[model samples]
Structure formats: C-alpha cells, structure tokens
Target: MAVVKVDKKGRLVIPQEIRERLRIDETTPLIFEVDDGNTIRIRIIQRDDQAYTSDPLWKAIHNPVFIGKKVSKKELDEIENDQWSN
Candidate 1:
C-alpha cells in the first residue's frame, strides 16, 4: 500500500513499487470510474502482450469491446499473419 498526493492539476504519480508490482508503464492504459458517490475505482486493463504482433496490433487486440472474448489459436494466427489490404 502506498499514499499518493494528487497535484493541482488533478494528476498524481503512481509510486514505483506499485507500478512495478502491477507491471504498469507509460504504455499501460487505465480506466477510472465512480463506484458510488464517494468511492472511485481504478483498474489496469489487462492485455495479451505475448500475442501482440506490433504496437498497433496490441492496441487493437486489447480494445475494451473485445474483453471476455475467446479467440482460437487458428483465428489469431490468421489475423496476425494477414497483411494489410491497403
């Protein structure tokens, strides 16, 4: 557990220890929402780093709309190896 101070601009630095434990870096995307009137929730959106073919691919693969989806190995391979039509 760590204490973070929110700066004037509503930005706070996540401590190094927590960041390392969460495997969070500059590339990680975060989601924030209000659980109730006084409580807020933050989550580090999980992603498939291993299945990422490139940076763009990583962004596309981890889209929120695709969460809880099960992609078969064959389908993923086909997508990864497929070249852009344009």
Candidate 2:
C-alpha cells in the first residue's frame, strides 16, 4: 500500500508509479467527486477528445458538422474504406 502526505497548501503529490499506471500526467483532465463522508475521489479523463479524432464512429458523426452539413453516405464509405456498411 502507498501512503501520501498533503502539503501545507493542501496538495498531495501522487506517487510516480501510480501516475504511470493510471496514465496521469501534468496535462491530464480529472473529475473530482466526494462520497457521503466527503472524501474526494479523483478519476482520469482518458479519452477527452483525442479519441474523437481517430475513433471511426465519432468521426462519422462529427466530421461533417465542421462543414455545416450531413455527409453523403458515399463520402462516409470512402472515409471508412468501404467497410462502414460491414
């Protein structure tokens, strides 16, 4: 088990091993919540927007929104290399 100390400024530095395991870094976005006891729980936002750029379904729905119209099925097929129907 790992133990951490909160500094005078109320900041706790997570251990390096834990950070690496959870893929947390300086720029990582997080969501903080509290339980009934008011202890805070922190979660890493793994996807945020990076996945939207490369994830096929997300691209299919969002790509054309940038140009102000729904894309043609043909264009979508081309983007998916004709495998979108499958």
Candidate 3:
C-alpha cells in the first residue's frame, strides 16, 4: 500500500513500518516475482524450525575468527554442543 521510488541503482528502500510489520531483517531473503510485467510480488523466505535452531552453529562456522581457515567437523560439533550445553 506504499509507493516507493527506485533509486538509480535499481534499489528500493523498504519503509520502516512495513519492514517492522513483516519482521524483515538484514538476513532475510526475499523472492521477487513479476506478473504480467506490471505487478511485482515479494515473498519473504522464512527459515524453518530446524534451520532456526542451527543458526548459531552456522554463524559460528562463518564467524570472522574462522575466516580464511578450515574448521574441522569435530571443531564444529564441539562448538554446537558447547552452545547447547550452556
């Protein structure tokens, strides 16, 4: 229900109210579809329960501290277990 301008770079800034209502965050993924070359539909890709629970482990594996280094499965398992144990 809101009209927004597409910037020169073709990026649209979603309004704050809409973002808050839709619970959109920086990490959120969106699917954009064009229908009849006139209507644009945006769908938010939501993470399932399992993905939500493992988010911490995913983040830890990609953490800046591990950048440019290969983390072993054992190390990842330890990190995941450590998070749950605490």
Candidate 4:
C-alpha cells in the first residue's frame, strides 16, 4: 500500500502507479463514501449514455414543458471531439 499525505486544502495526491493501473484521468468521475469512522471507500462511476436514454423515468419526463431534450448522435460525437479548456 502507498502512503500519502493530505495537503492543507484536504487534497491527497494519488500515486502515479495506482492511477495508471486504474486508467483514471482528470475527467474520471469518482464517488467517495465514509464506510466507517476510519475507513473510506472510493469508487469510479462509469456512465453509459445509452442506458440513460433508455431509462423509463427519462422517457416519462419527455413533456412539452420539460427543458431536457434528446441529444442527437451527431451532437454527441461533436461534443466528444471538442477540446475542453482548463
């Protein structure tokens, strides 16, 4: 196990080896939970756009007044290709 110290701002730097092994990058979404008084659990949240689109609740909310709209494949592709600014 690797030992790490939390900075003053409460951020801990994950070791490079662990990050590489997990294939985690800056954009990866992680979920943290306090399992007990001294233990914490960290999880990676994997998202599938198709799953969200096929959810029954998502379909049920497709009313005229709702602001959410279906994203086209082209738009999604464009977004994926677009470069994000820091």
Candidate 5:
C-alpha cells in the first residue's frame, strides 16, 4: 500500500515500486473510477505491440484514412513495384 498526495492540479504520482511492478510506462492508459462513493479504483490498461497489431478495433482507431483521390488496384501495384525496384 502507498499513500499519494494530490497536487493542486489534481495529479498524483504513482509510486516507483508500483509502477515498476505493473510495468507502467508513459504510453499506458489508465481508467479511474469511484467505487461506492468512497473508494477510488484505478484500472491499468496494458497491451503489447502484438495486441495492437492483431486487434482490428485498435488498428481502425490508429490507422489514418485515405482522403485523396482513389487509385485502382493496377495503379497501386505499379507504385509498389516501382518502389521495390528502386
């Protein structure tokens, strides 16, 4: 158990030991919830590189959309071949 102080900006730093044990990094996403109007629960969402690659929803959320003109399959293949040859 660890006691943390909330600063004026409402930010509390998790202890180093806890962070190390949980493998929490800067990219980690945390979910905070108040339980029973008294207890606060912090849920850590941990995912590996493989998870992001395998999960379609994650890919959809992170992948950028094509907004410009649409190219045909032949055009795309030609572009790929040209890049590979160079």
Candidate 6:
C-alpha cells in the first residue's frame, strides 16, 4: 500500500493509483458515516448521470416526500385495484 499524507486542511490526498482505481475526480461526492465506536468510514455517493426532463417519475425522485402516513395492505390493494380499473 502506498503512503499518503493528510494536508493541514484535514484533507488526505489520494494516491494516483488509488484515485484511478476508485475513479474519483474533483466532482465526486463523498459521504462519511461514523459507527457506534466513533470509527468514521467514507463512502462515495454515486448518482446516475442520465438527464431526463420529460419523465415525471424521474423528476419526483429529486423531490421525495415523507408524510409519516401509515399505509396498510388493504389500502395498497385498493389503490392497485383502482389503477387497474382505470
């Protein structure tokens, strides 16, 4: 394994080989998660770069909702039946 130094800004410079292997670039977005023991792990958040403007489903993906509503199986069956009837 190659040794890399962390800069004064608390940023660790990834080695060239590691960077190429991870396919990381300046635009790559990373997320850090800490476990119960306070051990931090870094992960890259990758997004599908496909651009779709005409699809409503694709647009809704960016604006998600959490209404905190409890949905039941009967309600799901009713909704599916309504959709099928239409």
Q: How many clashes show up per model?
A: 0, 0, 0, 0, 0, 0
lDDT of 1 by residue, 1-86 (tens): 77788999999999998889999999887778999997778877766543334567666775645547899999878877785432
Point out the worst 10-residue segment of candidate 6 by lDDT: 46-55
Estimate TM-scores for all models.
Answer: 0.51, 0.49, 0.55, 0.55, 0.56, 0.45
Candidate 2 lDDT by residue in tens digits, 7-35: 99998888999999888889786767887
Model 6: per-residue lDDT, tens digit, 1-86?
Answer: 77667789988887888889999899786767887694667787666544333457857886776667988999989989998999
- Write down the RMSD of all candidates, one decimal each: 12.5, 9.9, 8.9, 13.8, 9.7, 10.3
Task: Return the top candidate by lDDT.
Answer: 5
Question: Which residue pairs show backbone clashes in model 3?
Answer: none
What TM-score does candidate 1 get on C-alpha atoms?
A: 0.51
Clashing pairs in 1: none
TM-score of 5: 0.56
Candidate 4: tens digits of C-alpha lDDT, residues 49-84? 656557677667854344388889999778777835
Q: Local error of candidate 3 at 35, Å?
A: 1.3
Local accuracy by lDDT, each model: 0.77, 0.77, 0.83, 0.77, 0.85, 0.76
lDDT, residue 50, model 4: 57
Instruction: Point out the worst 10-residue segment of candidate 3 by lDDT.
Output: 45-54
Worst 10 residues of 5 by lDDT: 45-54
Best by TM-score: 5
Total backbone clashes of candidate 5, pairs 3 or more residues apart or in separate chains: 0
What does candidate 5's lDDT look like per residue over 22-73, in tens digits?
9998889777889987799998865665654677887878896675898999
lDDT of 2 at 51: 51
